[model samples]
Target: MRAAHIELTPTEDDRRIARYAAAAIALSVVEAAIPMPLPGVKPGLANIITLVVLARYGWRDAVWVSLLRVVAGSLLLGQFLAPGFFLSLAGALASLAALGLAMHLPARWFGPVSQSLVAAFAHIAGQLAVARLWLVPHDGLIAIVPFFALAALLFGLANGLAAAKLLEDAGRTRQ
Candidate 1:
């Protein structure tokens, strides 16, 4: 009997996946650059990239990409440990969970639009819960939920449309 050795090689698909992840990270940075009037609120344009990654690569990759985006984005913004950063982190985690659940759903049950909507809602709920429990002791922040939820709806739709377009393009290229 002879000992066997194995070496790994990067296939074309692996290279493509790496490129996609890089593109998603870059998109996340750009999304973080956009400013909103309210504090700790964002359209989370990077989520579109996460959604596309989830649809194409699956849940694990999406979670990794999303976590990377949140951590890197927070560092880049110099917001590490700030309330906003924690809020964003909470939202990202919730969004990842929601996306994972959505991926497990029947294909016909929820399209990208509905998936994004649900994820956005979950993200908001998570952030609100964290804010109430850890950041703010009083219920003053509760008043903003409706406004944030409305914004989430609009931004979620936009993110979903962008993700859908990206997925369509990726599918076409694959074919």
Candidate 2:
């Protein structure tokens, strides 16, 4: 049987999204290289990109960036379809869901900082749930919550501020 050949071409929008996704993936690889004092306590610098995309583009675009970061990042790290990938995917989906809802809030009251914090907490919750149910399955895992929460709060706020600055710079450059 002759093998059917299928060719797919990327549109301009696809190319744009690919650029953003590549940026996010780069951050992910860099984050993975950094040594962490505590498990799952990295600063999540990649998420700052997500926040910017969400504000400038939309939630759907942000979701694409986040999902691509997880899948492609994991593949680059040679951890595709592994336990870590699953946890990361779960965390990303949770954060995206929170961002989706948070975007509906008033922009004045709920800016990038608020949205970042919300996503960070949601990410931790999702990862913890997966860790408890699938990875460890022990009550002791709950003990890590307070620490993770604190990390999420601090990193989330910092990432939010960074994203805000990036957005501001982009706006200025565009003008």
Q: Residue 12's C-alpha lDDT in candidate 1?
A: 74
C-alpha lDDT (0 to 100) for residue 81 of candidate 2: 92
What tens digits encode model 2's per-residue C-alpha lDDT throughout 7-70?
Answer: 8998877787788999999998999999988977778889998999999889888998899989
Clashes of each: 0, 0
Error of 2 at 7 (Å): 3.3
**What's the lDDT for candidate 1?**
0.82
User: lDDT tens string, model 1, 126-174?
Assistant: 8998999999978999899888999899999998988888888888999
Q: What does candidate 1 score on TM? A: 0.84
Candidate 2 residues lying further than 4 Å off, grouped into runs, are 1-5
Error of 2 at 109 (Å): 1.6
Error of 2 at 170 (Å): 0.3
TM-score of 2: 0.95
